[model samples]
Target: MTEIDVATKAPESNATEQPAEPIESSPAAGPAVGEHCVTDRPTPAGQVSTGEIIKINDVEVYVSKPADYPHAPARFLLLLTGGTGLKSINNQLQADNFASEGFLVAMPDLFNGDPAPNTTTFASQEESQSLIDAFKLRIVETAKSFQIDMWLARQTEEKVLPILHKVIDGCRDEFADAIKHGDGIYAVGYCIGGRYVLLLGSDAQPTTPGPERPADEEAGETKTGPLIKVGAVAHAASVTPKDFASLRVPVSLACVENDALFPDDVRVAGEDVMSQANLEHEVRVYPGVPHGFAVVGVYEDATIRGAQATAYEQMLSWINEH
Candidate 1:
């Protein structure tokens, strides 16, 4: 399989009164309200049939369920959006592959509210720095705050984790019967989203630093949640050392050999953090893949494909074991 590389990054919420009139329910024949129903598209094999688009907590989220499967319903997967956003080629390929494997996939549009244009060319380091500055400014000005404890409680009690809960609940409501009979759920992410998977697993509390410590360290210590048996896969991104110190669940990190975003020394440092934490984790570097190799088929090398498949299979085994 081709090799790939990834870099780590830092990584939102809200509530409002609902007084609007309700819209009429879909006029189609299907399961009753709150029941999980099959919401497959009528497309030919190997093609994705668009599923449902729903408003969760005022955020528009798109959900896709597998077309068909004969196995018992005991497993589900949630695909989080990466740095390039939901419309990126890599995100789409991962979503389709997982859905085709009978896993429920949810791709939330994290950049939906922003007006940033998707561009590939950068004139210089100054331009890249400017873009980063703009992104940070926007996040500081627009992100929401939620009760950390309350959100964590919902993970086990409601079978839905925060951030993810809204999207999953929307899916369950739309396809209630299918989810009701389905197995537990898992989450996977790439790049920015990968960092989030670590954040969610660590259950870190959001707070400003007290005084002496660095700004990033001022964020409160990680909070533990009820063991929900979640298996998260993060590719090319590294978790903050302090955050990794608090993780209690099993997680895996896949590193790409040729990723310019994350250098070999940086990757080793990340692995060291995981080692110090003594957390059940694995970090494997693919020989010749570039960053985003797993999600993007940019390299057709056999080595890249094999590595991607191996990562997927390992994740499945971990999820199943849990």
Candidate 2:
């Protein structure tokens, strides 16, 4: 199988051309947690391995188009990676998987090149009494090393939103020109990345950051909105109920039972909030799994493997239906 290597001509931050929509420079409040998924990820079957890495200002973005890229029309998919950053094997695999699913995928280095350490490793089978215990140890190790509170301060919503906005603007400009009429934009966030994706979807109207643009640029066409039309998250971290308000866009949540970042109380509250938000939303629980189950979870366990596969399928189903 050959790889599809193509770089997106993502615009520079201070590009002269105005963005499709104004990106606001607001930081998300609260202690956002990062799920450090550190397991090895083999490329999926029939996946077009290797995506292009494009540099836009200070950020590095991994771009992956569908297997039959350039030949077939497809929707744009923005993938948000967890604490391990964009280059993590799992993240790369995730991008390729989405691309194989016929999406033009763009995964930016959320940590700007400096990703957190891969601290999530299980103890030896001999050391741990049971398989589940081994998996639990990895979860604890990851939590301790990440110091998520500190990481949040450094990469708050304020700092990260601007970068994402820039990427979204660039993607909209570059891909929309691919065909006469481009398809809609969608987003799927894993663990830490989920918080940012939710923030972008909540706003009824999100403006671009920096200076005010002219009226013609301010006007947003329904199809050309840089904001994600549909959003999905798997075992997300640091998402508050206030952020949930079901959001303005369609959303689907894949949650795990053993997640500290998103406890049972928070999950129930979020479900209630979304239930009343009057928006299209779905929240499904995966029992007996950890926070990173959807991304870099231990596939050895039958339960974990099954949940992981279903979570990924749910992500695809959400986008397809909505």
Candidate 3:
């Protein structure tokens, strides 16, 4: 088992729109989105997969259904995209991976098809390989055409949470006939997607400052319950102290070494917040691998690959346990 090390902290918008979108940083927020190069690739060969591209809210979504299971998958998982803005092949493979494990996966295109003004579209792995694989993507400047932060600004929590809810509804409606009783929706987020997933699992927390502020009697607005049953995040970015503070559901966070986005200070400070909140949570540090390794790392070294695999298993075990 990986050693757990996370805690909690702050919030940004009213839970009104649990932004898959990045809002302005509060005092407690982590680092903002970074400029990274992500390419779309097919699911690696030899793993059974059946995935379909569907549309929800006029945006394209990749839905992966269980391929091998004793029974129909009893859980629903929203496989959120990282900095790649949803066309990422890693996201597709992740969706399939979860689906293969009896968790129906619904991954929406956060950026639709075009993430930015000068983005390049690689129709297949062969095409992407020409430039990115040619250079091993060692130089971030090679993919200078695509900037993740420029796109994240447009996909705010207000804009994205509704789509997430719609995805959940569609999944439920599709499976309504087959099963009525099962575990509720769960979320798995990576990179920028991690912040959103945490919000989805959050129970309502105090909006106003101070210890236990009263409800907003002016609007008579009572807080709502969380959107998912359980959640996990890997190498999350743009996460804040406030975001952790508001969380009330069980969550597990996987941290990477010297991450510019989820830096050491932010990660360590989170522990205090979660401890005070007394939330059921686990946070682990996977040394050696870089921040985006969980989603986008392509490693030949056995050790790095093993760490990635183990962290993934830890995520699944946590989800299953909850």
Instruction: Provide the TM-score for each candidate, comma-separated.
Output: 0.58, 0.74, 0.73
Residues 1-322 of candidate 3: C-alpha lDDT, one tens digit per residue: 2443443323321234322322233565534665332443334556443688887656678888776543643566778876575656666777777776777678887655655333334333554467656676546545453354456566666566666766666766765532343457778888778888877776652232434545552232126578777888888887776577567777888888777788777766665556555567777787777566676345666666787788788788878776
Error of 1 at 22 (Å): 53
| Per-residue alpha-carbon lDDT of candidate 2 for residues 1-322, written as tens digits (9 for 90 to 100) | 1221111111132244332222222254355564344343443455444788897545789988887777877778889988778777668778888888878888988887666655535545574378788788778876766564555568766667778878877776677743223356789998778877887786533344444644554342112332777888887876766666426777888887656777766666665555444456777777776677787434567777787888899889888776
Which consecutive 10 residues in model 2 have the weakest lDDT in total?
1-10
lDDT at position 222, candidate 2: 18
Sort the predicted structures by TM-score, highest score first. Answer: 2, 3, 1
- Show model 3 residue runs off by greater than 4 Å: 1-31, 35-49, 68-73, 116-146, 177-180, 204-222
Residue 54 shift from truth in candidate 2, angstroms: 1.1
Residue 199 lDDT (model 2): 77
lDDT tens digits by residue: candidate 1, 166-215 = 56656556555555554444667665456556655665433324575455
> Residue 112 in model 2: shift from native, Å?
1.4
Better of 2 and 3 by TM-score: 2
Q: For each candidate in the order shown, give its overall lDDT on alpha carbons.
A: 0.49, 0.68, 0.65
